[model samples]
Target: MSPLIALRAFDDSINSNSSVDGVSVVKIIEYVVIGIVVLSLLALGYMGWRHRYNLKLLGEAIAHRKEKHALAHGRRTKDVQ
Candidate 1:
């Protein structure tokens, strides 16, 4: 809605016609549904982004452990312990 329309709607008297009141209940329901869908998508994107960071950290940890293990045990001719 335009700024002028918003101001007009708010300035209208109590006895005057309510632009919002004329709006259909279904339209309100549709808005609610759209809001829910948008929120859900945002949540999904956030989760994916967070998990990517977590996976990167996990990979670094694994590499660090492998390096530590190699350092603790000198390289042998055979891969066996």
Candidate 2:
């Protein structure tokens, strides 16, 4: 082949290879971003679940206190009889 033809072929090859590399790099970045988002969401969900559990425990404790007070009051009244 002529020198000019050989140079043209080399340039075309380089361009195609660069384009492929660029696409691969973009795909890698996309996957990384997706992974980060998923992890953040999971962390937020766990925190929310923990907060709700604490609230439930607090409510149960309050209910128990009320019941105990009522029982104590009833016992005092009976003893006065």
Candidate 3:
């Protein structure tokens, strides 16, 4: 079936009083599922961004510590340079 027909059928089913308090249970469930999907995508994006930022900070810290340790040893290695 076409999307329009499916939507029309859903609307008809809702209007035909297959609901509680004028709200279709299936429609509410669909909305809840959509909400969960959107929230999950947002959370995944946030975690990915945070992970990238933490990795950048960690690399910087490691480079700085490596340089400091090399300097204290009075030898500038090729890696530190």
Best by TM-score: 3
TM-score head-to-head 1 vs 3, winner: 3
Q: What CA RMSD would you report for each candidate?
A: 8.1, 13.8, 4.3
lDDT of each: 0.70, 0.69, 0.79
lDDT of 3 by residue, 1-81 (tens): 964457557777655667778877667766787799899999999999999999999999998898889889997755533
When summed lDDT is taken over every stretch of 10 residues in candidate 2, the lowest stretch is: 72-81
Flag regions of model 3 displaced more than 4 Å. 1-16, 76-81
Clashing pairs in 2: none
Per-residue accuracy of model 2 over 18-71 as CA lDDT, tens digit each: 435456433444567779989999999999999999999999998778777878
Question: Per-prediction TM-score, please?
Answer: 0.63, 0.53, 0.71
Residues 1-81 of candidate 1: C-alpha lDDT, one tens digit per residue: 964455445555334443477874444555787799899999999999999999999999998788778768974333555
State model 1's lDDT: 0.70
What lDDT would candidate 3 get against the real structure? 0.79
Please rank every candidate by TM-score, starting with the best: 3, 1, 2
Model 1 TM-score, all chains together? 0.63
lDDT score, residue 20, model 2? 53
Higher-TM-score candidate among 1 and 2? 1
